[model samples]
Target: MVKELDEKIGALPDHVGWRLWRASRAWQAEFSAAMRAAGHAWFSEARAGLLGHIPRNGTRQSALIERSATSKQAVQQLLDGLEAEGVLERFPDPRDGRGKLVRYTRKGLDALRDGDRIKLEIERDYIDRIGRERFAALMDALRSLDAGPADASEEASVPE
Candidate 1:
């Protein structure tokens, strides 16, 4: 069944969006596998998205919802799971008494370090396979396509 779907999709017209989606999917799988190998067996591509939006000092729950481009309920569910796993904690927002701020636990910070290191390693692998010049061109082209990434930048989340 999967092979049949693959054949059908493969027969369809190829375009930039299709290629990008396929590439992203492949990369995500590789990243998840790498995380598991690095002793973070609970890590996954979805959790990575949640983790990426968290800053060192922490951000409000509403801010996480906005930055992650996800529903408030969805963000809460993710937060609840992470909290259960001891990866993060939620605190009452001082500025807004009714609001909540989410911050990483010690475990999460350690995982972030591993994530950053793994990301760099992945980039080096891509450079070796595609050549540095070609990889640089690819990055430039990708950046040109979008206005810019979301206000997802917190600090040290993305590799230099």
Candidate 2:
């Protein structure tokens, strides 16, 4: 059985990383196409992720790095683009003299709403293709993978 499992693994065309990359790219393409069809040319996966992380109340630019799980430079670049597109604005933090708080403008809020709608459409499409039960199971599996051992040094819990 172990040798059969090894053979199966070896026969796979791509490893986990490659599969994940392909999946992410495919999802991003669908998301981008949906946004374009909705007349939102500027909408992108990065922007959507960033928008999801920012609270309605707003968030500090420095805080976004951790929240977005990205570098400060990358966050700054995204913020600059969003600002240029009139989606968001950065202003000095009231409590912190040097810190900047990023708040969604009216346009930003509208775009965020549109993104949410697009996301729902995409989810529904997936459910339709895979069925509700399969979709739910897929999401649960993904969540479990995400919740794997917190420390990299520790072994992940694999289900039998």
Best-performing candidate as measured by lDDT: 1
- Extract clashing residue pairs from model 1: none
Compose the digit string of candidate 2's lDDT tens values, residues 33-118.
88878877777878878877788778988888897899888888998998998989999998998999999999888876777898
Model 1 Cα lDDT, one tens digit per residue, 89-127: 999999899999899898888888888898899999999
Give the TM-score (vs. native) of candidate 1: 0.82
Each prediction's Cα lDDT score? Answer: 0.85, 0.84
Error of 2 at 59 (Å): 0.5
Q: Can you give the TM-score per candidate against the true fold?
A: 0.82, 0.76
Report the C-alpha displacement of residue 130, candidate 2, in angstroms.
1.4
> In TM-score terms, which candidate is top?
1
Q: Distance from true position, residue 66, model 1, in Å?
A: 2.0
